[model samples]
Target: MIPIYKPYMPQNIGVEISEILYSGQLGFGKYGREFENKLQSFIGAEYVLSVSSYNIAMLIVLSTLGLREGDEVIASPVSCLASNQPFAVKGLRVVWVDVNPATGAMCPDDLKSKITKNTKAIFHNHFCGYLGDIESINAICNSFGIPVVDDGIEAFGSQYKGRKLGNLGTDVTVFSFQTVRLPNTIDGGAIVFKDKDLYEKALLIRDYGIDRTIFRSSNGEINPDCDIEVEGYAGLMSELNSYIGTRQMDDINSLLAVQKNNAAIWNDKFTNLDTINSLKITAGCIPNYWVYGTLCKNKTKTIKDFKEQGYYATGVHINNNIYSVFNNNVSLKGVNEFINHFVAVPCGWWFENK
Candidate 1:
């Protein structure tokens, strides 16, 4: 059976991976720095930080925002738990924002209505790599002086209006490099900062809030003058994972090309289907097509049909609002309508390789 998602590995990467494994320097080092540099060049961002996972990446982004306890954050209900759970864990309240039923993306109108004095930040999740109305969302957030954090887990290679998602005027954008992502690091993520100061702070906080430069003296001994000024976490990516990430970056362009072509084929296939309506991508956006999302009249039957054809398909994520931990019970009309018909099918590198 074909998989809905699969990690891409460059041919003969084992030699480099094996070399890194046997090397004494297995911690976060040169490899991690190289990975960040490649990502910076690809995404066209001024500053980028490599982290252990997307969850930790979100945690680090939120930490930089200085949000207080019970601060309300407007967020899309249609996203992975990893995308929204970080808000609750950071002692912030999540205000559910409705998505456009046709596209399964955050509706700018709903987002404007949800904004209040208590709203500190906005979590705009680009569901399954389909670009949302980010320009409009950013406009609204800017008016209130609120920061926007983009959950670009499935949108690494996607572009919004000629600019990559991370540099598309958003305050902070985070991308996942998990196994199923386009550039799999096995398990890793990157955070891109639009602000240079926040980028510097993230550098310190990602490694236990200590100043690595001053923590040790010239002889590598612990320096007594060095101090831990702010709160932080140990969220550094290992050198092994960083080496793997760089290998993925080496072939990222070709992999993205195949995924885009497959998505085009699926778009044509669903165009005339009587029961299957393809989700609408925002204007002026180029999606990486993590998976081809559809709104089927008979969701169950559509999934079964795909399975019978030797492909895997299903709804990728449940609405985070359904979870009691989020404390958001307000029923969202668009989210309800979208989830009931949403189905995702394989349109990644695996299909072409097969």
Candidate 2:
């Protein structure tokens, strides 16, 4: 059976990994640094700190920002579990909000309604790589003096009004270089902070609250032995992963072109099929389609049809509504619709043809 998603491994990935295995420098080193630099430069962010996963990135971003217990986080309900857990993990209460159905993004109106006096930050995930209404979202949050952390795991290159989605809408934009991400690092993540002070703070938090090896010597000399572990986890990406990430980063433009073309193909091809629910895009927002998704007239039957047709498709994750733990106290009409109708159609590097 066709699966909903699979990791992309270009021709040289094994060679790169093999080289690292042979190098005796297996931990975080030059590879992770290069990944951090290349990624920051690629996204036009001021500074980037590499970490183990987007989950660690989120937690670090929150903890470094000084968000604490009784602090409330406004999060889009129509997001994956990771988006909310960081807040919960840091002892902050999460305020669930809804996303706009068309864009599959945070609704600014709902955001305005949800912001309370104790709200510390707003978190948004770029669901399915569709761009969020980031400018408006940022505007509202900034007016209320709220920090916004973008969960940009799925949207590596999604842009809003010419600016990338993560960069435009939030103070800290977190990305995952996990296998599921656009530029796969196997398992890694980073937090991009546009502000200098915030960037340093995040760096310290990632390294265990200490500050050393902060940069290469002025003469460009490097020293791994000179180090300090602050209040941090060993969440650095491997150089091998970064090497692959660099390779994938270089290929992103071409890859996105093909994925978007495929999205158009799916939209056009499925138009006549009334039983299909094609994914929607926000006007003027360019999305780097990750898992092209839809809802079926019959969710199960639709997936079965796609599978029968050699397409790997399946339902998606939203809130914990179906989960007994959440019991879902909040009303998330749009999120619930996404949860029920959600089915991801493959749009990665995988091939689909007769």
Using all chains and alpha carbons, the TM-scores for the candidates as numbered come to 0.97, 0.88
Question: How would you encode candidate 1's per-residue C-alpha lDDT over 1-354 as one tens digit per residue?
Answer: 889988787788778888888998899999999999999999888799999998889888888887767888999989988898888898789999999999999999999998998898998999999889989999999999999989898899889889888989899999999999978899989999989999999988898898887999999899989998877988999999999899899999988898888888887887888899788889988988889889999888989998998889999999989999988788999999999999998888777733
Give the deviation of candidate 2 from the true structure as CA RMSD. Answer: 3.7
- What is the alpha-carbon lDDT of model 1 when measured against the actual structure? 0.90
* TM-score result, candidate 2: 0.88
Pairs of colliding residues, candidate 2: 31-239, 52-235, 207-230, 208-230, 208-231, 208-232, 209-230, 209-231, 210-230
What TM-score does candidate 1 reach? 0.97
Best by TM-score: 1
Q: How far is candidate 1 from the true structure (C-alpha RMSD, Å)?
A: 1.3
* Cα lDDT computed for each candidate against the true fold: 0.90, 0.75
Model 1 alpha-carbon miss at residue 161, Å:
1.3
Residue 87 in candidate 1, Cα distance off native in Å: 1.6
